[model samples]
Target: MITLIAGGTGSVKIARGLSKTVDDLIVIPNIADNIWLHGLYICPDIDTITYGLAGVLDKGRGWGVKDDTFVFMEQMKKLGQDHWFTIGDKDLALHLVRTNFLNEGKSLSWVTEWIRKKLSVSTTIMPASDDHIETRVETQSGDMHIQEYWVKNGAELDISNIMYKGIESAKVNAKAVEFIKNSELIIIAPGNPISSIGPIISLPAIRKELESKKDNVVAISPLIGNKAVSGPASKYMQIMGIESSPFGIASYYRDIASNLVISEFDNEYENRIRMLGIHIYKTNIVMEQSQDEIILSNYILNIVNKA
Candidate 1:
């Protein structure tokens, strides 16, 4: 099976393309961006990938269901409720179902599988962990949930540290570890390494598994030049004391990934990344369109196939 570690919009784009071609694919999404809002469970990353795969995603907004109305959100606002995290009517329905299932004592992994199947999504999407682990951004003002930092505060604060609350007590999802250990190829999708992908690898079980299978692992750099294609990945990288460049990404994944994919725009860092003993593959990594995503997916698959 081809296993993908996915989170964030960039990762979801590639996951959508891979889903169309790879029948035996498994996607492990980060649950760190999950939150409880309006008495409902909200899984930002998981829902984005689920909607994208189900072909009902609002591509323009990069999240939520396409053509979904915000009447519920408007009504909530009229009631003086905090609706900073915009939830469309259709989007809220899924959250409601998920929350209900959780209250029924269902594990998150089980609920996620049920949701994917109910949406007619054939590709298997699993959370990194069933435990409640949250990503918190530490700033000068104070520590805030990742959603609050990004959506409520517009990600404007300078991050001093990032903490994965509940990770110390969290256990890696067993099936995720099994997939990573036995999969023929492992792709670390291009996402925010700090917040999107950090929480998954922060678990000792998952990290150790990847380290053991480093040869089969390939990481797609989120950085193009010194900036990320989307999100605040560059800022987080800098806060982590790593340069916001492809070279920096290579250094960060050096231990767990044997290969690194970078954009042609950042070819200057190819030699630098290679110096760290990582095999470099340069391409037009930006996927602004579905066709772009398909082409990149095929290219990466070919690279692994040849290996």
Candidate 2:
């Protein structure tokens, strides 16, 4: 069993690859990325995993379903609706089904499992918590939804603060906790610390439980050559007033994590990371495309085997 803290495109691919090999793979996707637009819920991170595992993902876009139509949005535009966040035709079906299940008072975790089951995905996908963990980004203009800040607007504003709304009340899924307790390893994928992995680790209990079993814990650095592989991870860290380096990220997770797997490009900082008394596994971290993903996955599995 593997308890994985997952977020974004890279995390989904890593989780999908691991699911094929691990006996019981449990994913706690960051719910802080959840948002409601035009009165419907959208979970980018969660659905990215689902769509990828189900083999319906748009390979080119690296997210959403393949051959998915956007006629819904086209119609919305004709009706004078502002389609800021574009949801494809087939993808809309998922949102509708999930929102309906949630409206019936089912927990978000339960709804997520149902979605995976309907799609016949083998991986055990779960939300970070059943509660609404919305990410609110305070910018120079005002507070905005995470998707608006990242997708619609391209992080054009200076981020004043990044908050996880409802996280204090968020509760981890029971199965996720059990997976962590019974896992042989805890592998944190390369993801944005501020907006991706941070939200899931924000829950105190999760942090406590993980720290208790830190011997098998390992994290992949999202940075290569002091820049992010994708997204605003470097810029986001700077705005959040954190340095963009493998060592700095190590400092952030030092309390709960025991080791880091940095990219080959960051060899110069390995000495600095060693100063923190944590072991480092150096390799190529960026999954430029699908082949890079497969290779990185195998490399990490080898490290796990060695451990």
Highest lDDT: which candidate?
Answer: 1
Shift in Å, residue 302, candidate 1: 0.7
Error of 2 at 183 (Å): 0.8
Local accuracy of candidate 2 as per-residue lDDT tens digits, 1-307: 7777888676877776677667677787877888887778889899988888788888778788999889999999999997878899899989998899889998888899999999988888877578888888998889988888887887788788898888887777666777777888888877788898998888877887888987678888888866887777787788788889888788877877787888887878888888887788888876666667677777777877887
Candidate 1 all-Cα RMSD: 0.9
Q: After aligning candidate 1 to the native by TM-score, how far in Å is the CA of 227 from where it should be?
A: 0.7
Which regions of candidate 1 fall more than 4 Å away from where they truly are? none
List the RMSD of every prediction in angstroms.
Answer: 0.9, 1.4
Q: List the residue pairs that clash in candidate 2.
A: 69-89
Instruction: State the lDDT of candidate 1 residue by residue for 1-307, as single tens digits.
Output: 9999988686999998899778899999989999999899999999999999999999999999999999999999999999899999999999999999999999999999999999999999988789999999888889999999999999888888888999999988999999888898999999899899889888898999999988889899998899899988999888889899999998888888999989988868977888899999989989988998899889889888899
> What lDDT, from 0 to 1, does candidate 1 have?
0.91
The estimated TM-scores of all candidates read 0.98, 0.95
What TM-score would candidate 2 get against the native?
0.95
lDDT of each: 0.91, 0.82
